[model samples]
Target: MVVLSRRIRSEDWKPVGVSELEVNALQVVRSVDNRSVIAGPGAGKTELLAQRAAYLLQTGASPAPRRILAISFKRDAATNLAARVRQRCHRIHAERFDSMTFDAFAKGLIDRFGQALPERWRPRSDYEIMFPGDRDYREFLSRQIGVPPAHIGTYADIQAISVKTFERRHLVGTPLPLDGWLQPTPAQWAAGCYWQRFLHEGKKSFLSFSMIGRLAELLLRVNPMVQDALRLTYSHLFMDEFQDTTPIQYELVRTIFLGANTVTTAVGDNKQQIMRWAMAMDDPFSAFDGDFGATRTPLYNNYRSSPELVRIQHILAQALDVQAVAPVSKTVGTIAGASCAIWDFSTPGVEAAHLAAFVAAEIKAQALSPRDFVLLVRQKASEYATVLEPAFVAAGIPMRNEAGMVGAIMLQDLLVEAVSKLIVNVLRLAMATRAGRHWTTCQEALTALVGIAHDDEIAQAKFANELDAYVVTLKATYPNSPKSKVASRAIVEDILRFVGREKVVAAHPAYGQGGWLDEVLDSVAGHLLASSCNHTEWSSALDVYEGIHAVPLMTIHKSKGLEYHSVIFVGLDDGAWWSFANDQIEATAGFFVAFTRAKQRVVFTYCSHRGARTNIATLYQLLTNAGVKKVKIA
Candidate 1:
């Protein structure tokens, strides 16, 4: 509730190109005292964060020769904030700013201060960090816990349990049960054993993602030099999306900089704390005030949505008993009456079809781009994918579902590996001018290429004979050419064509008419031509592919920290939004987060029945009570 002094020193203050509300937030950010800003959706929190970094440099709040560390929850967010800061701040000041995700920061700290780690925590020279999909680590955990590998759920679940265990350990300074997590269950025992072995094997090899936080905490607690060095290195620390901070992450942050002279600012919206399943605290503000002793400043003005949209959001917040801050809209116009509506359908398929048709119509009528829209589901599964994806495809609307993209990327990798092997074979065959010298290698290459081309033995033989003739033609065509150059370009293309890459990709369930698969193929071909198609390079390409402009279909959880001009919230019924087990606090928070992502318009859809359950009565009551008009369709 305390506001920083607004009086600015004339020399230190400069126009940072923000509105008055944002300016107020930036002033608090630039102040030397620790501060926490509660920023709502589209509140320009990221802009304020960037300006804060710039302000620190321009005003000399962060003295020269010291860096400002800005940490975000995700790598893309960190990279984006860093880019914006560099653009706005002075060249010299921007140069001193380092931005990275929390994991990156922790990993870097451990890498730099490994020698300072405790003997048990110290990593051996052969130590390597294995992630969730690492086969060896999964098998090792399976063996340690006596649970079959199939029962381990997912890498994400394993990671969550690991972090939860570490959080307990950090809280009590030893691994003890603070809650039901300590119950003597088989899973709990496995988790405990897995944590112990993970640390035990750190002297040789270990697998981890959550352990980074624990290791960083240990280094900062035990090694004062490391703390002092970091304190001296960073004059200001800024954390974006602080609500998503796990207990261990916050502990690490507090351990290193709580009492230091470094000015710290944590910006987040408690209402947007929808990542509870990820170990995010339900009440993040208390930690800011009680744990860090930071002053709180709330940024209430919503600059992203129309007045009508803001009104609806306020109603939802009030119903959920969340802090309802009425956002003053900076948007110019009112949304159309139909902009917000609840569509009720008799079946899920009908609902999906109508939704897709509505999107197509909106894009055409309003001159909107497909990228402006998003379809958010409560969960990503076959239930939604089967109904929704075909609907979009039939409607001629482009949609990018993350699950599908993942499949496409996996397929792309397979194709790339096949291409690489084929090229290697072609080059080997070209080098075997005198047959006996490299006959075995040439034969192996030909056999592999033919095997990759067809399943039937007769077809494989035909393809192999054709490939041999084509190689002879290629050699004759480029008699003096370097084998690699010929193989990389011409031969690679021939192999891709012979293997029916396009046909196979087009037949994939993940393939859309938008030619995303074609784009992936083109990218793979480009990489193959450059002779640089490696896992890392292909993975980077996948990241780029995911960023392409298209209508996104994802869960509300995955949709956090992203905004769209129009958001369609599907399955707004009771079972999807409310559960009998809890008070639905987390679900309401998630709903609030999803609704606020809209920039101009929002729509909610629900089926009359979800499997054996009737439609969500509570959701119906809440919407009708809030005066939300409903359109029922059969």
Candidate 2:
């Protein structure tokens, strides 16, 4: 092995911060074999991965010169893991940990080494990216003359077809079946036509995340040198949110290290797998067993919830699976009364007043802030906000619906998040005259990029000088201009131009070269930049942007992997969760995820007699079984 080791200590093995992990977690962390850690809510999955990374790096347990590669489903998740590692280990050892999203990893490989891909499948280096919603796919499906939706399947099914395997063998069945997915000759030819134009364009091919994944797979298959290099570079693979692994993601992982010498640890909870379709497997844990020879380790300590709250979660878990064992709560109760309760309301106004009273009492008695409480719904947080915001307003409580627009465009677009962070960082330095924390922060950011070399002093110095000059140019260009959409777009454009687009895209691989960036630029309006502040001083604006100043409200899907001191599940009645009948398992999983989001308390609020005296009978039964008291709000 080439001489490079960030090993901080000799062979002395013990976890560095956080000693609450049990024997099972410790075993999973230190085990050299492939493992699948499937545990319920708040079982310390992220903490376990961090400790494992620390063990490998500090103890020199892993093969020398190889790095630890962590692939998460979200960018924040990747960043969070990287941050935790940095907190737990030395800087040099932490530098050996590479964390990124699945999309970013795939896109990076293709961007750097796609020349080796097969000629027909290789995308142009200048390929653009597309993020299509149902409306776009609907228009495409409508144009087909005789194919029928049954032949090609729905837009959702068509969207699932991999660009890497769009051949007739994968699409068409022998006799052209009447129903189900991709069986007719017309469907096969039609899909091939779409993907062909999508993949091999004359001017510039259009690539989606799926197209990027397939191309990355093709590149790996064609280039042994690249595959060998990757295998040699990374000996440990830590996959977070493994239950949400999609088909393309699964195949790509298998393509890289199916039978390779890498130690892979996947950590997730099946009860929290609320994401749909493209997730691709019936049981990913079992799939992991068959493919990677992984040992399944289940963690049972409920470190997040109180005993009463865990009991409620257990009731729902039992309803979903008869053999489910309840996780023992490791936390002390914070509330003196019932930790889990249901409130029955006859009117919205009275219900609002009652909640305000309860919140005030709780704040006085327990010293909890508004941020400690969260309002969760099965779906449509914005619609519920229309009915509930008046309550918060009447009480002088600040509440925000996360599903509401962030900027002017898509709710949580990747490009918007990346570009926003970039501008904010640059602005921070632009506002700073000398080199201190600002320069260090910007330098750390540049070094942390996947494409940047931490050891390259010359490149680092050159980029640092460029950043200083860019800061100068930015202030000169704007010079105390009021924040507006036009000004925001121009500022963003100037920053992108000065720092270079390729550099930013390299930092954020999923910020694909497309009209989406232009759309995001258009949406970077004054409201988002200033947000609850009078001007563009960074700290004042970031307070609202980071959810520090308001009460939290969001859908259950968005609330996954998040925790609060108090969680209120709104709309327990049947109408709000009408789609539960379509898929009961998924519904139960969603409810389980929502209930476990509290460390001390969970309040289920229902307007039982407001409209039609409606209730979800199954949910009520579970609540009754869990011994939750129903309090009437008058």
Candidate 3:
């Protein structure tokens, strides 16, 4: 075994505070063997993972030019880890490290081995990977499964079943058993039938995201050269959020480098494995057991939360049947008036109003920014929109919800019309420039660019006459060449000025700072400069920029791997959280995950009645038993 302290300088590799548990985990990372790190919440697992990558690069454990592959369950996680590694390691060696999500890794393998795939799996010339859309495909499945379109549940379910079948390594012609995770419902049976046809149609049709993983597994198994190349390319593999990994994902990793020279590290909290319904395995530790001989390392330190928060997490972990290791916290003193509280309301609407007011009061009292707070719910739906948005508006609080951003960008008619017209005019300008048309006046183009109707001759002539003089001045100041950077800048500035950028920003403060409009303009100008302006590209750019900060509101599932200074977990009634399962394990795990998201304080809200039933007895008992204090809202 190699000791990292001896191999590397103290200044180069720090974070050593004489803790036995952290020492064990760090040793495991520096070792040249397989290891499984069972890191509980707030254990600094991400920092540990980032350090491991740095160690491998700095200590020459992984030679230069040979990469270390770090896989994360989420894109943000991967990106953050890569950034951390770059900051810690030397630039020359840090460039050898690569990080990506599992789906992205699978897609890369598929692209490399597309020609070597079996005929049935081989894609046609125009075949593209389609997402879980395409109503025609779902209708085709409905006909085959002897069900109507409405009864097909969702394309998501079909994709899940298909991925699960491949994970189990079931043969092509085998009937997907109705036992285990798959129930014998009409929808399940339909999914099973659709899974088979989904494979058959892979040649000419689009492949779902799940199919990418299955294909990568197949390609690796059938092509030994690709397997060897991959094994040699990466010297170390570090996977974050290992507990959330599906079985197929584990198998894919195992097939590529299990018996090879590559050392692997899997880090996650088994207690937070709440994604079992999405095909995450019940026992993630089994991935490291037998054949691999992985060393187990546990990290129990709670560095992010107060001592009070750590105590609550310990109690909840015990209730959920997860192995409870009391978190060691250095923050001995709790914040004044920061104790956990459960708020009960007479009505959902009233609850929303109270929540908005409470958040405003907390922000002022703590002198915290709006970004420091997060509102988490079990589900985001019409109820959230109706109750929360108006209440926040009435309270003069800024709030942003992920669903709202997506809807505003994708559904708003005015924004959509403006973006579409911009794309069209950009494309037309590119074509005219390519054809060497020198006499095209900017005034006539701007008239069409604004989407003015050709039949409205009076309005067109009026605008064209006003802008004709301006065009002469613009031509003198800026070159007429399409590819010139100066020309692109002038066009973007003039269009933004004409489109009332100031008015747009002033009207929609929810879009965040002034930079958002600039981002939109830059995206449009980049596309126009490249002569690649299309509706899809332009809409995607708008969607990306529309995600600027307001105040993050998301479901608990989406809130995983995220933390805030103050957290409000709303809609904690029976139907929303516990209704997802008959057994209490999943619900308990979910609540545990939600509770640990708070760094300083947590507020759990529940209504007296949700749609018809009173508050759930089980939930009330769990909270009271866990020692949560009941608080009255003014």
Computed on alpha carbons, the lDDT of every model, listed in order, comes to 0.65, 0.72, 0.64
Which runs of model 1 end up more than 4 angstroms from their true locations? Answer: 1-12, 125-193, 201-204, 320-323, 381-383, 403-549, 574-580, 612-617
Q: Which structure among the candidates has the greatest TM-score?
A: 2
Rank candidates, TM-score, best first: 2, 3, 1
Candidate 1 residue-wise lDDT, 280-306, digit = tens: 766766876887788888887788888
Q: Which stretches of candidate 2 lie over 4 Å from their true place?
A: 1-10, 133-138, 145-186, 200-204, 407-416, 425-443, 447-481, 490-501, 525-527, 530-538, 608-615
TM-score of each: 0.69, 0.84, 0.70
RMSD of each: 14.8, 5.6, 13.7
Residue 488 miss distance in model 3 (angstroms): 14
Residue 420, model 3: lDDT of: 33
lDDT of 3: 0.64
lDDT of 2 by residue, 71-129 (tens): 98766667778878877776668878999889889888987887666666677877877
Q: What is the C-alpha local distance difference test score of candidate 2?
A: 0.72
Residues 1-634 of candidate 3 have per-residue lDDT tens digits of: 1223234653466533233336666686577888888887888787787677767776778876689999977665676677676556654565677888887787777765756876656544334555553454444543444532455455455444343333233322222232312443434455445555655564554555466676777778878899999888999999888888876677788888878988888898888887776667778777575557788878878777788888888887887654577878755544687568888788888888888887788778878777778888887544576678788868877566643432223211222333434434433333332423422433333554465654688997777665545544544544333455455556767655654554434333312232434555554455444432221243233322232233567777767787888888887776675464454677677888888888888898877667422445565566677688887654
